[model samples]
Target: MDLDTGVALSRHDDHVDPFPVRRAEPAHAVPAGRMGYDLGAERLLLHTVQSAEAFESLLTTGTLRPDPELAEEAFTDAYEWIHRMMAARLPTRGEGALWFWARTRRKHLVDTCRRSRGRVLLTCRVPRERVLLSHFDEWHLVLNKGLGMPRLPGESEDDAFARWEEEHDDFDARLRAAGMRDAPVRDWPADLRTEIEKSWESIFDRGNYGPFECWQGTTHALNNDEVLEAVRII
Candidate 1:
């Protein structure tokens, strides 16, 4: 299968239209690439979503939140609920399927973790070494999907790199269409870091958020400065 087909299917349109744009269907409901280890014919199936209202509701106003210590537990509860919801319609028995949600600059990411009950695998912007690896049972892996390039199965490493380079411009254009006007850090002045810190602090003060700590991925590594540059240009 063409990699672009899969890549296109994986990503959501980031562009913001002035008109009231009706939200598209959830990504998890659609067919996606299979993940996890396969045992003979017994392959582990998976799905991913940028957002899940069902999962979000369980954590936000549910009985799952009893105290600040149960923050991770709440996240785990949401994760499990999402898994079961997806697994019921999927072929796999939910033994080992993967699901992920990302938060680009949302400050509440950490508070979300603090109020959760179970473990949450947060992908944040900080370095991996700074994080407590023991909190998560499995160490997170970095998935490098360049620009608009879709992820394909069985593609050669060389081909994937070539595709990333060729499609980067398209990806950049797509980002521009989104409300993101400038690159992440370049757009920020010396005084703006204070605002970023305050945003994080506000979320920490409130116990109604989730964890989304930034760290280094094994496959692709980008420093904070580099990441900011890329986002700004987009």
Candidate 2:
């Protein structure tokens, strides 16, 4: 595949040290989104509802409310969990774009949640221009820091790098066959890196998105027990 991948990933020895510890300085700004799951910071939870009535009930109880502008859109009776992902590596726009994207996700997330009417988990794998999920399905997939390709399964890190370095002959051919795209890329800000990694949390932090916010004044617990998470048998 003649594809340019997203962000430079950090690859440690997947078997020996899958989760290495590195301390990042606190975010320079007051943190616009959730930190990465690897960090101990809180994760945002949401109570997805299907109608204005259900949504308004939560508001009355001071639980949750849809963004007024966003809520103007009609919702349906379908109920499902939509696992949507957002990427916010806005190098050109800087912090302003981060806040803008975060807030946008907050509104759009409810729209996705509202259309879910089954036991399906609707997931959107996003634009490749930004650094996408790392260690998503398996930790074994390591980006050869030097070569930037997935290390072959069971290959030692050294061997992977060696193979990756020597394989430029048919690299682009293989990448295109694997459905990769040729795209320009840039690095994310160190401070916003964690937030983008867990950008899903931003959907519940509507208050941080804009001055005219509608989230109830509460930090929701990190589970579905208190949430209106819906499911249906297939």
Candidate 3:
């Protein structure tokens, strides 16, 4: 299983649908990677490992594991015992300390991560005790094939890095071809609405719009075009 590196739909594409919409046979999706930074505990955890298998774990289950880095398991028991063990190592930050600057930052990160669901990976870990304010302030992450470089199953570190560079450049070319342009974001006008309705029926053979949110976002400078119907997103 390589990965699903499909080109996500963007808001700015001039044409959102193909001239002649035809349903094609399903095919194996390419593998893709997502990387980001995380403010964990009192340290900054930089996103480093993102394998197809790890991503699969996230896709299947919401929680991340230590080995495959992702897995499916019900927390019905709330993992009460394990929680206690961790609490022993790092006592829960009491309410009084909630007013502390560190706690405030931690809450921001936890809340945002929850809102983004499980698609995010925060790997860059830097301790607040050592990192300069400027570097810490520059913290950011993006989920796209062109962003992070994770070592493949058997590839060398250098080889994986090179592969990522090539992938990023290729992705840029596609965006450039689309003129890095997209349509304005607004309520779906009648014509666009009709196309979207068709998308629901044709794209997934379903009735309601399942991918509504996926195709929506503020238009920005990004390569996006519906003309390229043969786009093979990983």
Residues 68-164, candidate 2: write the lDDT tens digits.
2431112110000011222133111111111011112343443443454332221111122321122211111111101234545577879966775
- The stretch of ten residues in a row with the least summed lDDT in candidate 3 is 215-224
| Cα distance off (Å), candidate 2, residue 113 | 36
Off by over 4 Å in 1: 1-38, 42-156, 181-234
State residue 96's C-alpha deviation in candidate 1, in Å: 12
Predicted candidate 1 versus true structure: per-residue lDDT over 176-232, tens digit per residue: 665343544224343442333232222111122224332111111112221110000
TM-score of each: 0.21, 0.19, 0.20
**Candidate 2 wrong stretches, greater than 4 Å:** 1-132, 135-148, 172-234
**How should the candidates be ordered by TM-score, best one leading?**
1, 3, 2
lDDT of 3 by residue, 24-82 (tens): 12221211332223323465332221334444443345332344112223321112222
In angstroms, give how far residue 225 of model 1 lies from its true place.
49
**C-alpha lDDT score of every prediction, in listed order:** 0.27, 0.27, 0.28
Lowest summed lDDT across 10 adjacent residues in model 1 is found at 225-234
15: Cα error in model 1, Å: 58
